[model samples]
Target: MALITRLSTQSESFNSALRTLLAFDASQDESIERATADILKNVQQHGDSAVLDYTQRFDRVSAPSVAALEIERREWLAALDQLPSGQRQALETAAERVRVYHDHQRAQTWTYTEADGTVLGQKVTPLDRVGLYVPGGKAAYPSSVLMNAVPAKVAGVPEVIMVTPTPDGVRNPMVLAAAAIGGVDRVWGIGGAQAVGALAYGTQTLSPVDKIVGPGNAYVAAAKRRVFGTVGIDMIAGPSEILIICDGATPADWIAMDLFSQAEHDEMAQAILLCPSASYLDEVEAAIARLLPTMPRADIIRASLAGRGALILVQDLDEACEIANNIAPEHLEISTENPQQWADKIRHAGAIFLGRYSSESLGDYCAGPNHVLPTSRTARFSSPLGVYDFQKRSSLIHVSQAGAQTLGRVAATLAYGEGLQAHAASAEYRLNLSN
Candidate 1:
């Protein structure tokens, strides 16, 4: 009945065992990669016809033309109008909070004049268009529609095109409602690698987007990888991750369910708990055994917990903080009395949930901050998606006549040192007083 792993930092084998527990093989399947490559090529060469054909083959939804796949702006609004009162209110509230949070992230253009009258700064502008890919099949995540599209719209992206797969050609009203509330310019009921390809390569019916954002299955991830250079893409998200550092003060069932929140994501998802109290770890284990049977996705949660989840006894709260930084988890919960102290000590995490009341589930839903965060320890280098993702910056330089004389000589010196005679001559020509 040992459903999950138990470890101790004091054990002689702890380091090796920790490595084994933390290891995740994120390599894409060769078959998926090849399939994605073929799809991308076909979409590139054949345009709308290729997309229509693939939609029939992959998603099993047959449309006469790719244009028929598009869900018009009025339909998006109708979807919004059809929503139940509570669901509609929730979507509107979440959208407003997300928009308000991103408004602070907008970068402004600035230029400063030098003593020689040289002007230097940078200009920031929003992307013209963006593509959002929402997963549709078993579930409809209206939250995802808000999370992806709201930030892009807040960044002032003019057009947002959305793609979601509908098996049996059944559309989810909430997703469309979210797209409407999020201000998406267009919506296309299509998904898988073909949807990604259509967005990346631009078919006759769907215009190519500057960047593609949102989540999908393995095939979609591979297609995004193949088409990265042609267009920008959000992070290739891995399985869900949650690491909680508990001080043993919170109720055990609360912590147990928190672990289960991420574990239900799938087998590859990881959920780990670090605590200084052995008794608390025991209490959590008991809670997991008692509560897990009641979960609807009990099999998935059990598989995820047994495969990658762990509960480790650390030396102290300080030691738990150190290990948390090393893990660089996607979702970190500092469940303690003085959570801020431990939070301040932490250096890497996609998002940090502080105190006993702050749950990772809240961040996934109505949180003002972004929920689309870096995964698989990518938080160490990459950041969560934000308004900055949809904005590009260009450096501005206006050199005065006197400023050019000074800058031209410096440029000539560097060009001469690098042995570029043409570059040196070009700089020298600017320095010359031509008649």
Candidate 2:
């Protein structure tokens, strides 16, 4: 018996089976929602006192004040300096690559004058401050720190405040090192709904941030969803996903490991392979069986594979690409000869890795592109986190005397048609005025 489900596009039931496999209930847990709301309200009302109380209860670390929870710059620098040479070099190199990649995504202000002498353009400006939420404790992700913070710095964000839970009051040094390398301005020993609240509503000690970005558990996701209007938030990411379109030319063992990479993230993560060869699918399944026992996270891989993973035999490479477009996976790997040809056909994907050697893990770590990507089919409409996420644009309009005379009549006519008398009068007032 195979650990992952096998499907054939020729089968009549394939469409229904695929739908069942793709179904993920994203509804918020009512109990968790209520709990998160209470935390946000308490934090908003009592300020730092409420944040401290929740931090003590949830994280088991009591602090004299929220200000005391601040992790100083010296500690971050020390963490970076004290890391083993290899680890320090890796962090520095990854940060530099991420920074360089995001630099190209920075938006600039531009203006153009009309023939009538009216100037219209856009003003691009970075957010004043941003808050980054990092999952901590046993699940430290220094990669996430670089992915979130480096882009903001590249966008010219003045301050990037990071909040991570120091469970049992022990901080992850790698996370601290990444923060130092990524240009974070402040760090706080905090997490959960309270952390989101502190960033959104601002306590006495912590200033509010313009936007919050990063991944967290259920309560944190709910808090971000609830406080969206109060402060901007990145998308509520779902479990990680990877869809591999294989030509069966790549080694079977390599494909198996690629599937395992996303499966190890969690039991809910999805991994799927689409290929035109039935024999190739069989070989990959055999590889999975042989490799499963050797992995440290074999149990998680097993569960995720059994629950959502699939080996789909498509009609051909063209059909495989079509199916992949529908899936809109977080990561898409085209493992074939001339992978770029298939990549050119792909309409939606958070990230695309071309060729056999271009592994998804490389992109996740140091491939010079943002690893913070859209998940759960959001790739169809959204984009990867980049410098653009941290900067905003303001429309610039400077009307010359003659231009306003021509524009005001059009504006007044539209306002009058909408039955807005005051609006029409306002536009009309500017009309026929001396320069």
Q: Write the per-residue lDDT of candidate 1 for residues 1-435, one digit (tens) a residue.
A: 469999999999999998999899987788988888999899999999998888898778899999898888887789889888998999999999999998999899999999999999999999998999999878678899999999899899999999999877888888989998998888898998899999998988888999999988889899888889889998999989999999999999999999999999899899999999999999999999999999999999999999899999999999999999899999999999989999999999999999999999999988788999998889999998999999999999998888888999999999999999899898778775562
TM-score for candidate 2: 0.98
User: In candidate 2, what are the lDDT values of residues 1-435, reduced to their tens digit?
Assistant: 459999999999999999999999999899999999999999999999999999999899999999899999999999999999999999999999999999999999999999899999999999999999999999999999999999999999999999999998999999999999999999999999999999999999999999999999999999999999999998899999999999999999999999999999999999999999999999999999999999999999999999999999999999999999999999999999999899999999999999999999999999999998899899999999999999999999999977988999999999999999999998888888554
Candidate 2, 81: how far from true, in Å? 0.8
* Weakest 10 consecutive residues of candidate 2 by summed lDDT: 426-435
TM-score for each model: 0.98, 0.98
* Model 1 clashes, total count: 0
Residue 355, candidate 1: C-alpha displacement in angstroms: 0.9
Candidate 1 at residue 355, lDDT?
95
Q: In model 2, which regions exceed 4 Å deviation?
A: 433-435
- At residue 346, candidate 1 shows an lDDT of 92
Query: Which one is best on lDDT?
Result: 2
- The segments of candidate 1 whose C-alpha lies over 4 angstroms from its true place after superposition are 432-435
